[model samples]
Target chain A: AQSVAQPEDQVNVAEGNPLTVKCTYSVSGNPYLFWYVQYPNRGLQFLLKYITGDNLVKGSYGFEAEFNKSQTSFHLKKPSALVSDSALYFCAVRDMAGTGRRALTFGSGTRLQVQP
Target chain B: GAGVSQTPSNKVTEKGKYVELRCDPISGHTALYWYRQSLGQGPEFLIYFQGTGAADDSGLPNDRFFAVRPEGSVSTLKIQRTERGDSAVYLCASSPDPAPNEQFFGPGTRLTVL
Candidate 1:
């Protein structure tokens, strides 16, 4: 089984400032991590995923995440936040070896508030 | 490319009524999944279909929920005797035939039970 945890319920950041959304995971095997963003009345949009690559993975809308093996964390980060970027963010994970098993487990979600 | 499409963007019905939500996966995609999203929560997996068969339904709350993916393209989720707790947005997503691929999501059908 695999599970994800978004430690913060909400994160506030000023426009043009850097921001970070924390995410941690627990899985029976090696983890495949993903990040998704949801706008109001919209579906979850794929941001990025960490399968087998570098620790810092860049994604759409200038977002990136660091996959830390030791800490078991895959935190989303941005150099300069945008007010339009305010939305709900989710972190998900699946086991690498759960081939026939479901490959996605999402966190509770973290609300990102970018103020001007 | 056309993303996944779902029908009945919004549905409202009284308790004990039955509802069906539809989904059309991206063209040629072989993996379809159904997920339910409650208020202030992330989407929870309901079922997964590989081709025309249901490969997983572990997340389904009970026997009242059923889904089908005949012909391996379009899928429908049927809920019977709906309760107030069944009200939520149902999302459908599809990916390629293999694992570790990104899943495209539909706009989702908001089912509200009164």
Candidate 2:
């Protein structure tokens, strides 16, 4: 089975400061990882995905994530945080070789709070 | 270029009742998925349909939960004997064929069971 772990329930950062939300995974084979953001009462919006190739993947809203194979982690990052970035974030994973199992497994979630 | 859409944004029902949630995937998307999001938790996979067939229903919790996509564009998730524990947000997503790198999700249907 594949799974994602988000250790922090909440992350706080001041405006213009850098921010990071950690995520790790456990899967049998290669993994397809993705990050999504959810605004209040809104559906999850795709942020980015790491299918293969580049280790550092850029996403919407000036967000990026690093895929560390050695660490089995994909941590979401932003150079400078904005108050509008405050929202719920989720990390999801899917086994590349898991036939017929295309559904993604998501982490519990991390709440990002950016203060002005 | 409309995104995925789900019907009945909110539904409230009593325990032991039956309910169905609908999902209209993005036009031309061959893959559709259903997930449940509990309060304070991320969305959990329930099922996945490729074309007109259910490629995966492994994530479904029990027999009471079922889903189907008849024409391959629209899907519906049916829950039988709904329990209070079933109350949560039902999220639908769709992706293009070949691979599902990024899924477009709908606003989700919030179900409240009393």
Candidate 3:
């Protein structure tokens, strides 16, 4: 079984400041990680994914996430926060080696509040 | 191209009633998935369909929760005897293929069972 944990329920950051939403995962084998953002009444939009590449992966909307093997973490980062960045963020993980289960396990979610 | 779409954006139903939710995936997508999102929580996988066959349905909570993707394009999720606890946003997503591809999600159908 695989699971994702986002410790912070909500993160508040000021505009123009850097922001980080933390995520950690546990899986039997290697993991494929992902980050998604959901605006009000909108479906989740793919931000980025970490399959098997550079630890630092860049994504849409100037967002990025670092895959730390030792710590089992994939924390989303942004160089500077904007008010428009306020939304609900989700972290998900899929086991590379599994019983042919393609389902992704997701974290509870983190609400990012970028205040002006 | 249009993204994954789900019909009946909102649904209010009485407990014990049957309800159906629909989904239309991207034009060329061959993989479809169903997930449920509770308030304040992230989406949880319910089922996965590869083409017209259900590749995985382990996430389904119970037998009452059923889904079908006939002809491998449009999908429908059927719930029998819907319970209050079943009230949640039924989300549908799709991808070109199963592995490594990121699933594109729909706006979701918010089901409210009273």
Candidate 4:
């Protein structure tokens, strides 16, 4: 079984300030982690994924996430926040090595509010 | 060059009625997936289709929920006896192949049972 945990229900960041949204994952084998953003009345858009090789992965919309193997954490980061970035963010994980080629397990998501 | 697409952007139905949601995956993507999203929650895996066959249906909640992709390009999810609990946004996604499961999502159909 694989699971993901996003501790915060909401995160507030000011425009032009750096932002960080936390995520942690649990999996039996190796973990394939991903981040997505959802605007109002819209489907989720893939932001970034960490499969292998690099601990730090950059994604779309000027967003990036760091995969910390030791702590089992993959935190999404942005060098500077923008007002348009306000949306719901989700963290997902899957067991890439599992036999099932299982579906991604998503966290309860965190709403980000970027104040201008 | 189009992304995944789903039909019936919004469906309002009475309880006990049957409703169907449709999805058209991107051209050439071999793997398609169906997921359900409730208010204030992330999408929940419902089914997975590889080619023309249903690769996995473990996430389907009950027998009333059925999905098919006979032609391998389009899929339909049918719900029998619509209930208030079944009201949610049904999302469809597709991926290329093999290792990367990076699914491209459709706008989804919001189903409401009255």
Query: Docking category for candidate 3?
Result: high
Interface C-alpha RMSD per candidate, 1 decimal: 1.1, 1.0, 0.7, 1.3
lDDT of 1 at A85: 93
The candidate with the higher TM-score, 3 or 4, is 3
Cα miss at A27, model 1 (Å)?
Answer: 0.5
How accurate is chain B of model 2, given as a TM-score from 0 to 1? 0.97
Q: Per DockQ, what order, best first? A: 3, 2, 1, 4
Give the higher-lDDT candidate: 1 or 3.
3
Q: Which tens-of-lDDT digit does each residue in A19-99 have in candidate 4?
A: 999999988888999999999988889999999998999999899999998899999999999999999999998887747
Q: What TM-scores do the predictions have?
A: 0.98, 0.98, 0.98, 0.97
DockQ of each: 0.77, 0.85, 0.91, 0.72
Give the local distance difference test score of model 1: 0.93
Q: Which candidate is the best by DockQ?
A: 3
Tell me which of candidates 2 and 4 scores higher on DockQ. 2
lDDT of 2 by residue, A43-100 (tens): 9999999999999999999999999999999999999999999999999998899473
If the candidates were sorted by their lDDT against the true structure, best first, what order would they fall in?
3, 2, 1, 4
Assess candidate 3 and give its lDDT: 0.95
In candidate 3, position A95 carries an lDDT of 91
Task: Answer with 1 or 4, whichever has the higher lDDT.
Answer: 1
* Count of steric clashes across candidates, in order: 0, 0, 0, 0
Candidate 2, residues B9-97, lDDT tens digits: the string is: 99999999999999999999999999999999999999989999998888899999999999999999999999999999999999997
